[model samples]
Target: MRSPVEPKSAGAWRSQIPTGKALVPYLLLAPFGCLFAVFIVAPLVYAFYISLFRDTLVGGRQFAGAANYLRVMSDDKFWAGLGNLFLFGIVQVPVMLGLATLLALVLDRGQLYGEALFRLGLFLPYAVPGVIAALIWGYVYGPVFGPFAQLAEAIDVPAPELLSREAMLFSIANIVTWEFLGYYMIIFYAALKAIPPHLLEAALLDGASRWQFVRYIQLPLLRPMILLAIVFSINGTLQLFNEPYLMRVHAPTVIDSSYTPNLYAYSLTTANQQYNYAAAISFVLGAVIACASYLFILVSGRRRRR
Candidate 1:
């Protein structure tokens, strides 16, 4: 009381304390918020900051605002990698998702004899790490020692050049499909399992055949999951790197430095030591992923509205 500062009243002090459900949300979210700020936001800002400067022999590190981004815009290798991803997504995504859906339907029928074994077998490849999976497939696709090649020799037929330029696209697609098909299948299978028992009974009461039940009831319900799977597939396709990166050892001619956008960015940083440019390329890729995902969502939304 004698000092310049006055003591706060009890009500005023109580009012300052957080209480009830309002604070609960923030308390729960605080961990994730802290992690996002430290990990995600910090790196992105730092990378962007790094991307603004260019290293030069004459001037040393100097501000070259937007120069790296401009170079990325005209970069043929980046464009080629993007194109390759597009083509890969176009063919592989549909095939993979389609197979997953079919497998889910078959397994959900409850008629398969060894259902658990079947499911586990399908999902086993996905359990294998991507690098190991790529290496395993690389050996399978090897020209000389691979089973396919050896079989062809035994039969006096020409061995399939799986790692060759013409076949490399499908070859890599095959590995991706094999690895992730089970994962997507499990997702669809779980979705199928989650369908209400009442709906199945109602459909049965209505004299709906298996095919009719699937087409009308199951497919309609699964549309959302299918869209989700497609979006995930697109994202994975854009971020393609591992298979091609490892396959380089087997097919150096086909799997070049700029095989996919991720691979290209990695090569830029490691091989060319173009850290700033690589950062720009990574940001560019992030932008592409965001745009592609948004466009697909928009299209799906419109289609659903119809």
Candidate 2:
């Protein structure tokens, strides 16, 4: 039959196709979008709003305009804290990422025995809560009663104090690296695994040595993941608090109240009773992190284009 024309059938097929296509993208994005709005966007907006006001104990609240921001700009402690973070970022980031990349490569080698156990051991520290990690490491760094000191004493050598002002920054960085190295290693490993096996096989057939393969094949493939890991590490370093905070409680002189931006913000809110100032500092810190992340992404993208 010229058929009354299968209009309903054709329409149903057309509708189903579009619906299936639309559903996939939406379903993929739904969870992340919800979380982004709730945790990131909403809190950011609220923090920005809080930064614009002057909180008071007795008087009514009033808009401070940009006074809080200006105060933060002029505050030496804020600048110093940010500078410390910058210093940490410069020294710690490359070391951590390099180690992570190396570990990932080692683990990705099929010849490694007990690869799963090694990977688990490496990443296990990340599962520990940050506070607990900090506390455990804090005791380990204590010279008077910690393991290092005991070992040094047994060996008849002077115990190196990790909490000294001269070594505090490095000490904290070490703790951080120890805690997060495996986590980033896993990320790089995953990225490495995603590369096609045939590509490496071809490189090997072409007489490429291990270092050559790493430099030309593996590293190039890992560029995106490395950049992502760098961005995350920068953000974490900038917001460092728990390690220094716990360390400070153990050795007060080693880590000052304003050891990092987050610690400074905490001090402002709790010790100084300056919630408004704390909020303003937080907003500025957030802005700095956002800008730094954007710049890293931009530079990485440009390099990739080249």
- Per-model root-mean-square deviation over C-alphas: 7.8, 8.4
Model 1 lDDT at residue 140: 96
**All candidates: TM-score:** 0.91, 0.84
Highest lDDT against the true fold, candidate: 1
Cα miss at 232, model 1 (Å)?
Answer: 0.8
Which pairs, if any, clash in model 2?
none
lDDT per residue (tens digit) for residues 261-282 in model 2: 8999999889998878898999
**Poorest lDDT segment (10 consecutive residues) of candidate 1:** 1-10
Best by TM-score: 1
Q: Write the per-residue lDDT of candidate 1 for residues 7-36, one digit (tens) a residue.
A: 688778565567787699889999999999
Candidate 1 Cα lDDT to native: 0.94
